[model samples]
Target: MTLLAIPAPAGWDLDLAHDYDDDLPPAGAEAPEQDVVAPDPAGLAAVGLDERTALLDAYVRGELGRVLHVAPGSIDVAGRTMNSLGVGSINGLELQARMEAALGIDVDLQRLLRANSAAELIDCLAGQLGPEDSPHKSAARRSTGTPAAAA
Candidate 1:
């Protein structure tokens, strides 16, 4: 699971054009594409997720779509590094917007752009908006599995 939250970069949405497919090509088959699977709300709620969690899930899915080259549906949490390595610079602006949307609060995009990783972005969000300061932030951290100390 990426540390970055929702409303991923520009063109990220298009990455989800294809759904995750079981017939993933072999590692060398072709250039991969990313897909964004919708979150399972019921499952999230069962795990104590809030609306921010759902929003963050969407944002993460969108980021996966934006950054990966594998078929959209083929993305898994384990593939994040591989995906980042395959793409050019991540769209920080896009991700920032998505994160803000997920949190349902405004974020300093300029501050977020400085982060280098998805996890870093989560940390930035947490630092920028204290956990107790925003319910969305609290929920997002729980759902994304971000550590309080790191935040």
Candidate 2:
């Protein structure tokens, strides 16, 4: 007679598990979810540079209006090579303010000095936009609005 091997139920692999010598605690210790964090400042720097380049191209092409949308797979200032709109220093500040508002970050003229290009600004934004970094946190603290509690 041939011996047949029966398949174990799901999650029955306990080869790596050990039994406790004494009484055990309740089962299922849940782990906390972590927030997403940016890899490094280098990535941010690259984004900043790319933004500046895209702005220059948009200015030259007379398509500065499209400059507002500069995310990846979208309109890129770095991708375009030529334009005619003339992106001056004053325009850069305006662009920065718009970006800050869109991204919900505090990017002022001083912050702009810290970042040389769009990529770098993106990196900084990433850090501030982490899962735990909620712009609405302050509002929640002040009880300005009620949030639906997690189920």
Candidate 3:
């Protein structure tokens, strides 16, 4: 077998033994101070039933609009069921995955299938979620229209 030699590009160095110590900060140098940002309490606390239901309602409506390629306001989440909306099993599964990912929770597929309407599905999801299921907290807090700390 014949071997071929390749030439290095202009200004490219092939050396691998250079000392890196000169590039590092002095041993006694202190690290720069960084601002510590706190996580939003609203995002970290488990949401109450009503708030979870509302969040789910909004999320479901948005997802339905995205999957069906319709306006979110036109979806009528509270008034219609998936079956009535012509959402097939595949679309239902897609919706389920989206909900699970958005809420950071796992949903039972069988229960999801059993939910006839968007409202029913939201109820089912809310029922399944425990206090520890997610970080978002009560609907009352969200409905007040101000952060708890600010209030």
Best by the lDDT measure: 3
Show model 2 residue runs off by greater than 4 Å. 1-88, 133-151
Per-residue accuracy of model 2 over 33-150 as CA lDDT, tens digit each: 3222223323332354445334423332222343332222343334332122233456656655554444334445555443444444343444443334444222121122443221
Deviation (Å) of 64 in candidate 3: 1.1
Query: Higher lDDT: candidate 1 or 2?
Result: 1
- lDDT tens digits, residues 1-151, model 3? 9999988999999877987798766899854432223222344346667876676666667777776666666876666667778677887787667655555455555555655677877665555442544443222233444432100
True-vs-predicted CA distance for residue 71, candidate 2, Å = 12
Q: List per-prediction Cα lDDT, in the order shown.
A: 0.45, 0.39, 0.59
TM-score of each candidate structure, all chains considered together: 0.34, 0.31, 0.52
TM-score of 2: 0.31
Better of 1 and 2 by TM-score: 1
Which one wins on TM-score?
A: 3
**Per-residue lDDT of candidate 1, residues 1-151 (tens digit):** 7797667788666576676775766666855444445334333333432443434444554664565443434544332442253433355555545545544445555444433544444344433344444354433343455543222
